[model samples]
Target: MQYFIQRHPLNYDGSQLQSLFTYKNFGLMGDSVLVFRGSCTVEQNEMVDMEDVVAQDWIHSEDMLHFIVEHFDMDLEKTIVRQRLLIATIKEELEVRGVTTLRRSGDDLYAGDKKLSVSIATLSPVSTLVHCGLNISNHNTPIPTIGLTNLNIDDVFQFGESVAEHYCAEVLSMRLARCKVRGVS
Candidate 1:
């Protein structure tokens, strides 16, 4: 597992949830989690979640901190697990930084009634992809939103790095546990 923070601001239009996004965009080979600052506008054509499309939910945000994870294994269930794990890691990081009133509802995060993040997981032909975006500014969103800046978190990149680091560690820990265990007769 590898992680890097993208310095440039890349707008996420839901098209980046493809395999090799990290490798093609940032040159990080193998399984990787990339964090960046971006604007999110996922039109219906680019959406992978059918529920959102059926509900006509508009996924948009003015400014966000985005995390894109790509793993070679092709398992949607495992990818969803990783998606939730990433969300939990973000909540843990926020709590560690002394921020309160944060809640995890499935793959999304909330600060009170206002939403703090959005996420989804799906499988490509070659990899499992996850996109998790944390709101940086509450403007230009379809729903009531709360951002990191609202909670006094100014170092967005650092926050992203911390979340990615912890997430990678947790994934590695799980892999280690699986490999080190002996099979019982």
Candidate 2:
């Protein structure tokens, strides 16, 4: 059996997106049989109480381990256990930064000493690939040559111009801003 997932990627903002997206088989393409889901499904780590058992992260479940074990044939019980333990710590870090990481399939959040019932949408590995393919086709050009770190001041301006022209209807103000700095960061 092969597994592929498709979901829309979260935008920079917290708004829900209308466009559908996908990722390709969760990076498992070859019939040669690469990693199958790799013991990294969101459900394994987070606990969900759907009914709001308490006001905090005190929700209850028998355990998601079986669900995970059922999903993967590799029998990675140890990996899942370790990852589940680390999830709380990672959630704390995300809370400190005020960034809530979410996936499309699960419902639960760890934020600032609270376990809240939350649902977020995220792209599957397949949706990500589809987005890249569409971007390539629309541009009708080779992939970008220079990484962000390699960009110079002129390159930055040019890149902004290209983005503005393609995405924005008006670039006169943006073009003016590009030539001058407005204020301190």
Candidate 3:
């Protein structure tokens, strides 16, 4: 370690290396913005930064995001640490898409006999409007703009069944394409 540091000095030039430096500052240029289009963060996730994205910055209102979405199969013990890592991963990806900060929202499981809608709602009406596609019903609620966390998963089978029924699709087909549970474990 001492030899490596002596060979290549990493002097802190008094400018104070902010965490934002990790992003490589791609948001400065007008033409270099990233783009991604897909159902990227269902079984996986997509995170955005709040500080990087301004109020006036116009983003295309599509279900797709303009960044790389990652999927992981983790078996960690603690939720807090998992949340922190997820936040960091999401932050890095969001920066690539010209966004900053995250807003954690409460998740709701709306279920009926053959219907269900799993949605997460932000604390801020602005965030809810901006991210979650929320409407006028949340005008009275305030959106928190600090730290963000991910929601938990439950009964994927039930969810799949509901989605298939609602959309008139095949549950087995989707599972065959995405799941890794078929072959040898």
Which candidate leads the pack in TM-score? 1
> Which tens-of-lDDT digit does each residue in 1-185 have in candidate 3?
00000112122211211222212332321111112222212211122333223432211221222121111222222222333333333434434444343333322111122101112211221111011121112121122111111112232223222322322222234446777566766
RMSD (CA, Å), candidate 2 to true, equals 21.0
What local distance difference test score does each model get? 0.93, 0.24, 0.23
The worst-scoring run of ten residues by lDDT in candidate 3 lies at 1-10
lDDT of 1: 0.93
Q: What is the TM-score of each candidate against the true structure?
A: 0.97, 0.21, 0.19
**Per-model C-alpha RMSD:** 0.8, 21.0, 19.6
Tell me which of candidates 1 and 2 scores higher on lDDT: 1
Error of 3 at 146 (Å): 9.8
List the pairs of residues colliding in candidate 1: none
lDDT, model 2? 0.24
**Candidate 1 local lDDT, 15-124, one digit each (tens):** 88899989987899999999999899999999999999999987999899999999999888988999999998999899999997998999998878999998999989
The deviation in Å at residue 84 for candidate 1 is: 0.6
State each candidate's clash count.
0, 9, 11
**TM-score-best of 1 and 2:** 1
